[model samples]
Target: MPSKSSSHSWHVFTATQDPHHHHHHHDQLSYELPYTMEICMTELDPVLAGKFFRRSGDEKSGHSAGKEMTELTGINEINKEAFICDFAFDPCGYSMNGMDGELYSTIHVTPEDGYSYASFECAGLVNNDDDDDIVHVLRKVVQIFRPGTMSVSITTCSEYNNEVWRKVAGAVEPLGMKCRSCAVDQFPAIGSVVFQTFTPLRWKNASK
Candidate 1:
């Protein structure tokens, strides 16, 4: 079962140290600035999934305050969902909301099959001048994915430069992981990197 606190949660994408220090508390501008992604995944918990799908497709959900929230779509139907992208171009800032800490637009994906992945452009914060901070963020992501699994792969770096990625892979190779691999592309100007994974479904036997 999904924990009570983890379900139907809210997040604030702030560029300021104090997110609550609103530019205008009573106006729509308060929410317009923050890039928000409402997370709706099917298998965060099966019990929740059953309850959610039980209602009529047009029925209002308690979590939505009478607004109808529909069924999952595309990759969202899987047990794991896609990483939410944040394209805000700004410096990092401290966050004080739920699971609060220093937050970044960077998104990391972790599958229950013991594999973790990270995808960011070389021009992003992951490859910024601060090497220590970059490693620390990656470590935090690893902890989120598999608490004890040290092996990870840098699956996507949008700045299609192998030499730069090689340097990054080498830097984190010693971080208590069995292996560190780089998944890259050759001519990114004409092509992009795409990653895919599968989810397993189980069935029971029937007797005649």
Candidate 2:
């Protein structure tokens, strides 16, 4: 993103015109309070990343592979109580969605050699617990991927905005990940949007 751009950047995330927001499921989320999470991870552990690749060439369908991966990756351990549906792509890749009542959590992985990436997100995950719940969920994801670098973005409705946005660093730093950058912005009905980037302590001095 450039410091000075044409009118393109602002239009990029505007919900009203965003094609994703126009999608059926997203379009239906008219919750009075909605908290959305986005996490991008890169440089995953080779040993763990390799597990996402298919074992038997064409022996299994996508759903079968995904089910194996869900247990293989301990994704089921993330939330023992929730029922999960997972699918693995033919050659390599995995995705799953877990639903708990009306709320949901999802994970996607592209566990390739040089460009491994994974993400986890939950929708309006916690109606309460403010930052505590956010910390718990994200930390679990960090343990799974153990990415060398990661960035997180959180969007929440006005009600929990104040309590949630400030906790990103506190949730991740104890695990040896250091918050490298933080930026914030407000959206029309989305309330607060906070973005933060992190690197492990081995990468740099976490202290200011």
- Tens-place lDDT per residue, model 1, 160-183, is 233334433444345433221223
Q: What residue pairs clash in candidate 1, if any at all?
A: none
TM-score of each: 0.28, 0.77
Summarize candidate 2's per-residue lDDT along 15-109 as a digit string, tens digits.
55443332112333333445778788889989988889998656988888898888988888777777899999878999999987877889999
Predicted structure 2, TM vs. truth? 0.77
Alpha-carbon local distance difference test for all models: 0.26, 0.74
The model with the greatest lDDT is: 2
